[model samples]
Target: MAQITLDAPASHAPVRLGRLLTIILAGQFMAILDVSVVNVAAPTIRTDLHASGAGLQLVIAGYTIAYAVLLITGARLGDRLGHRAAFQAGLTVFTAASLACGLAGGTGMLIGFRFVQGVGAALMVPQVMSLIQRNFTGAARARALSVYGAVLAGGSVVGQVVGGLLVSADLFGTGWRPVFLVNVPIGVVLLVAGARTLPGDRGEQDRGLDLPGLVSLAAATLLFVVPLVLGHEEDWPLWGWLMLGGSVVVFALFVVAQRRASAPLIPGRVAGAPGMRAGLVTIFLCMGTFGGFLFSVALHLQGGLGYSPLRAGLFFIPGAGGFALASLNWRRAPARWHRPMIPAALVVAGLGYLGLEVFESGGVGFEVAMGLAGLGLGAAFSPLLAVALTHVAVADAADASGLLVMTNQLGQVVGVATFGTLFLSVAPPTGHALTVTCVALAVTAAVGACCATPLLRRRG
Candidate 1:
């Protein structure tokens, strides 16, 4: 177990604590909210810009790609630069990027700005968890984590709703632009509040950036991700397959390089930790299903059911509300509950997927399917996170946290690329494709549940 450092006695007044926490939470919510917020707006963007399917995918994937690639580097930068400086810088960049996204005149510009926005988000997000870990201890830390978990779930739900509202409102006749523009006000407030309130942690400033490792990792990811993302669009050409093969080689090279590097980007020991390994694998599977489900469902509601974006957004509210309630209560639940809860949640989510499959033929049962999925997801989300981080040492906490989130993003990218390709390949978008995808998600959930069995048994 990593030794825990007691926080330096807080000098701030009691009233200031609330403001500090709020500022931190607002920053956290803003970064996370942007992840899902773009989904509902995709159709509007497509219409507004006359984008092809490939163009639309680029808009979403570009952000995720940038976000994933930069996250670890961002965290390390925080450790080097002082969390407060990194946080403020990230917030400023994120806000400016949001404005650029809003004013973007075409698909290419918007996608580029989204990539920049993601870099800002990557820079900002790690600080939230790091700050919480640094400032709080024991029960306080647990409580703070619970709150953060709720914020994560809540932000995702709110993103969908907010995107819907913006698209539906078409404020200032800006259509999809408001989805990006809405962040400006929120970002400004967060930046100002963070500047005033967030404490600086500048203790570890001597560590050097791992540029070599960063290059290798980025190259490896591009090799793999480019193929997965663009393969279908380009009809699985020879170069795509060649790139996929090269990704394996590049990944091997990356592993070797990291092992040899004087200052490794990702410490070999941290990545090799059994607990971290299991946790990341679980996150990958869980989020893979999650990313695909959200993308497909949004499309289904809009394309298949002909629901307005607002109506589609409304459908996700129950899930979000349920997630918030469950996350808030998560810490209070028994330790034994932790072992079974994640698997049970996966089972529940699987059942929801099954429900979706059964109800795909009709419009009337859509809400019921969504509700079941939400309840299951809400119950499982926090528990999975708690379980994943259960064995992490405090010193490695930041690294472990970065890995967990990176895995989640990677899962989403792969899920969207692979499953989306499957869905699109069926052509003419049919209920059958939805049914198959739902069943596949159910199967994925079952696999997650099976993996959790050992965890539950060991805990028992």
Candidate 2:
């Protein structure tokens, strides 16, 4: 038995990593882009569609709900249908749905189309990491993961900026339509390039779809997320609470189904891997804090401080800049620096967040704090992925990738909902709200840092 090196292709001689990453990341970038971009365009959408409050909320939340619900199943599909095929198919659906979203005549139409777009995204996203797992090993894989992590961090900020610009530009009097339409051309280009560049499956075929596990999982996710996304908007109706309770039961059943199924949606051994398990928890805390921090800051800046959408969006740039700088060299950093990076990132980010609480003015102080937080974000993301996948078998990579992504999404939803509740209930001043959120974020980062301590002791 010998170690598999990234230089040695597992399938057909390895596709060029550069080309592969470009095509795969293009699709993922679009998915991540849509997540934040819609928030910027929400007002325009409501006005144009004459949407009611409930309808407006759906317009924003539908895509996320659908995207979250289908992710695990989508990863299984990739394993079964083949990654290249699944990737292209998902993009095609996504592109078409994006076009439909742009042309949507009413709120209902927009919400429906967005849900379809999410399904497409779910099908496409898992393949990005799974393919990276198949195509590259060790250091090359580390670099590729670093690139992916950077895009994940930067793409959200890009969405903020681009969304603001597009809405404010009102390009061709299309208003919010461009936010959705923007994906159309990008999807077309990626599809064509991806077909040519992405690698095929590495001799593993789908071992049959686990329908029971999938249904239970989807039901659980739907139940869990619906309450989180809609509860606040709808004033926490009785049904919302019931759904939340039901989600736990459904999830328990899903676990039971997985234990019994011959071909489980998630392989138990992969989930059981010690490092992977810890990584998943750390990822949840990291992403939950990240999501809550972003939402809280955006609300505070816009609602409390009276900054316009464009200005608030611009405010996030320094952080994105810091993330770019750190992630660009993440893979090149020394091995000894790798494990220490997560806790260091957590400490840096926590301190920077504290600065956000203490700083009185918005000149150099704000930028420095943001930059530090951004740098930590990138550093933290890079190692988590690298370490989580360290022990995953190639056959289980897609499942692992899907689970990791799903946890991140769930964390985001939980973070937003929970912190948002506190934000609303406190009725604090702008500074106080920001401080509260940042304190929570700092605590979360610390927890994540503790979880990541295990990485320091892990050996090849």
Candidate 3:
């Protein structure tokens, strides 16, 4: 098969970075929203379909399982097929799956459809970063990356808002179904726009897909993600522990397979990029705190404070807003400041958590605390990503993208497993549990700040 390098866009067609980013980002928003929106609709779904507890759990976990496991494979496919083709195909599958989920008459169907939806997300999401890395340069790259990070962070809040609104509005008395159906029109529009505007590579994949590496990696991801995601719910059963232990072996096998492959899924240059390890650690800690904070906070709000689901969801809007504002504009700071910004901003995030602990009573103080956290996080993430990718050749954009995204998903799972468990283990007095959890999250942020020394620090 014929192929061109990442630098070679198909000469037959024009590449519009602006148009392409818009379409791809829209798809990303939809995919991330689905991850959390379903939580708001689960009770209604149970009532509608008389789902057993296990079925409801499956409906949620199935998508996560498929998505997390297949992500690296999806990224590799994007590299081979061209990001545009992979993204479009993923969007098609997701849109169709969303419709099927909305129309499902039973829990089993919804569960199956949700997994298909995740498969679509896995195929599509890695391309967002790959495309940005390929098309944008200098300040433009920074800005595009900022917007990508905002969309990455903000999608969960928006999902909660949209899901709550749809359920509460019960549009046409469809209840929870509209949450799924709402994606249909948006997806259709993106599909059409993307087809017309997104750039494409002009050739076929040159090498065979890395089947051994793919299987090993998939197994490794499942072993880590499944145990993290379900272990808490399962009361940390023996099998989950075994899976966790087995993951080390699978990961070792994957690393060996990747090294032996003629065309590896993750190239060594991309993996060895300067600041790569620190970037991943920062991303992990950032996402973990956010995940654990989101989960435990929501529970505390609803059960301890007697807030409605919508209210609890809406409370997060301030954090999302602050994050977007910070991410979209923070690159204007001086070069000298960039090295120190990550740790400084993360310290701010730590302070925000502490402020929340103090102002747990609510009102402007609480909102302010949330916004402060977002501000710090948003300021840090984009720069961290930029610094991380500084040495990664554009040719290996897909590999960098896949690595970052996989690390992010892993961080969230681990965060939920640990912090969420702490929040749940305390009997009654959820306020106390929330306080304890917040303190722990704050401490984690402080550690992240210490750990997140950008490679630029040495240069500066």
Q: Between which residue pairs do clashes occur in model 1?
A: none
Q: Write the per-residue lDDT of candidate 2 for residues 95-167, one digit (tens) a residue.
A: 9999999999998899999999999999999888888887787677887787787787777888888999999
Against the true structure, what is each candidate's TM-score?
Answer: 0.89, 0.95, 0.94
RMSD of each: 4.1, 3.5, 4.1
Q: What is the TM-score ranking, best to worst?
A: 2, 3, 1
Q: Candidate 3: give the clashing pairs.
A: none
TM-score of candidate 3 on Cα atoms, chains taken together: 0.94
Model 3: residues with Cα > 4 Å off, grouped in runs? 1-15, 458-460
Model 2 Cα RMSD, 1 decimal = 3.5
How far residue 161's Cα lies from its native spot in candidate 1, in Å, is 2.3
Q: What clash count does candidate 3 reach?
A: 0
Candidate 3 lDDT, 182-261, residue by residue in tens: 98998898889888977777423785678888888999989988878777777889999999999999999888888889
Q: What is the Cα-based lDDT of residue 380 in candidate 1?
A: 68
